[model samples]
Target: MAKWDNMLSMLWMLRSGRKLTAAQIADSLEISVRTVYRYIDALCASGVPVVAESGHDGGIRILESFKETPLFFNSVELKALVDAFKFARGACYPYTEELESALKKVENGLHEEQRHDLSHQTSGMDVISPSRPPSVVPLLRELEQSAKEGRTVRIAYRKANVEQADEREVDPYGLAFDRNEWYAVAFCHQSQTLRTFRVDRISRLEPTEARFEKPERFSTSAYFRNQSEREREADGPLAVIRIEGEPDTLNALCGHWHLRHYLTERTDREARFLIDVPTMNKYLPMYLMTFGTAIRIREPLELKRRIQEMAYGIAKHYENDPD
Candidate 1:
């Protein structure tokens, strides 16, 4: 059971015609008056129309309009919430304490039968995200708060491979978590464009007083999809590049999100992938060399030529030439 069950009980108590003092609520709930005040703060934070009163003959009560409204979540809906929380808890997001606390409250609200159903759902499921540094938790919390309030945030961000951190002011849109990491999608004022920042790479964060309106069409899912499409297109027109390789090589390619989706055919011996390597002349050689001779490029004579040039360059490096 959640220690903050008093929040619910206090709300129910305030729903009656009589206004209740903090001391009265504390006495009824058998907790300290200070605890009652904390529950009231929490209720207000959650958007409850709780009004506080002071002086003699004064107390607290919820708005009259809220009393008659009955809100409920069915078992399936509750289970969905539990599952989501379960996944999030495992995601490498900072500030999981609040999420765990909220999950506990949700669990405490469930009936025994519904809880049994939730238990069954939770028993066999697990999510595993790579570990993150403890320092990033505060930054994540600030970013989340800014996103919720539509406020701006300033941060010193460094890319994983970059040596210098850049100061940026951003309008936080939303956050995303994958199996490997957490990301914040934001519109950057410095770049005059939107960018994604790895949460762990953010070295410093501060919420600013400036607020911004979120674009109507902006969504994390859509943004990522479009970003990916642009990258694939930027490399030039899509080409059908077929490779003959061992099964492990195909499995390795399938591990990549873009490559996996475009994988048209797969067999124990080989796999065919249609991809756009726009910078083929620059990167194709390096990429092919990664798999060594285990793979062979079967199409697009252009890529084959580039690969040969790369191999020739490597061969030349070992040759003894007199100037």
Candidate 2:
């Protein structure tokens, strides 16, 4: 029997309200008497209230109070546990098999009515991800382990738009997930700098005997956010973009993931953003065009001209076609 199984059997035997000697428990569980003593010590440490007496009446017995105390989770706690697991599973948590086994044990401990209640509570609740996530479970598990153990690993990483994957060794500091992608924040040996890698882009990963000490208090999410801020700053001088529209429309535009960060001011009928020239030329025209006449660009005549060009191109593309 497993260590926990033997210990649980000891607990049940001691719970019988009869004083049982160490020899008796050891004999019943087919373990050494010293092992029984160790199990008793462990149970006591876990607040089981096991009483061990010495002398002619020396034996072990669980406290009567503990024997009567019911071990079960309340309805609210059970529902929370199940719902939390659902969210974790949806996020592609690395320890899914262990999580499933733990949830099964929890459910098995419930009474039939409690089980029915749990099923009913969980039936109406679920975590719906945006799309089916990638199969990076194995990569995640390996990176997580390496990060925790302060180990370095070699990987064949392919950057975006790159054809061939490049081989590099890195000391994985941590991992983060954002925008439906997994990223590893590690110290790249080749670059000799801390960098983030898209986990799915990793074509191959192998453990290395080399080890490294991760910086103290390093946070993957914080690093990623900092990198984004740095990238935005590196985009050169930003142009102040002003727009006027319905209050609701301006609000929605300002709330855009990219624009929100650059937003400098807002009013009932107007919003201002600090946008770079390249971004203004590349993405804003097409995106803002979706708003149609509800909004108007109040500044930066260059952007207005780009929008006009795009609109004219669109009209020209279908000019000779039937409506």
TM-score of decoy 1: 0.53
lDDT of 1 at 117: 78
- Please give the lDDT score for candidate 1: 0.76
lDDT of each: 0.76, 0.85
**After best superposition, candidate 2 residue 109: deviation in angstroms?**
2.5
Compared to the true structure, candidate 2 yields what TM-score?
Answer: 0.57
Q: What is the lDDT for 176 in model 2?
A: 87
**Residues forming the 10-long window of minimal summed lDDT in candidate 2:** 67-76
RMSD score of candidate 2 (Å): 12.8
| Candidate 2 regions with alpha-carbon error over 4 angstroms | 1-77, 127-135, 233-323
TM-score of every prediction relative to native: 0.53, 0.57
Return the top candidate by lDDT.
2
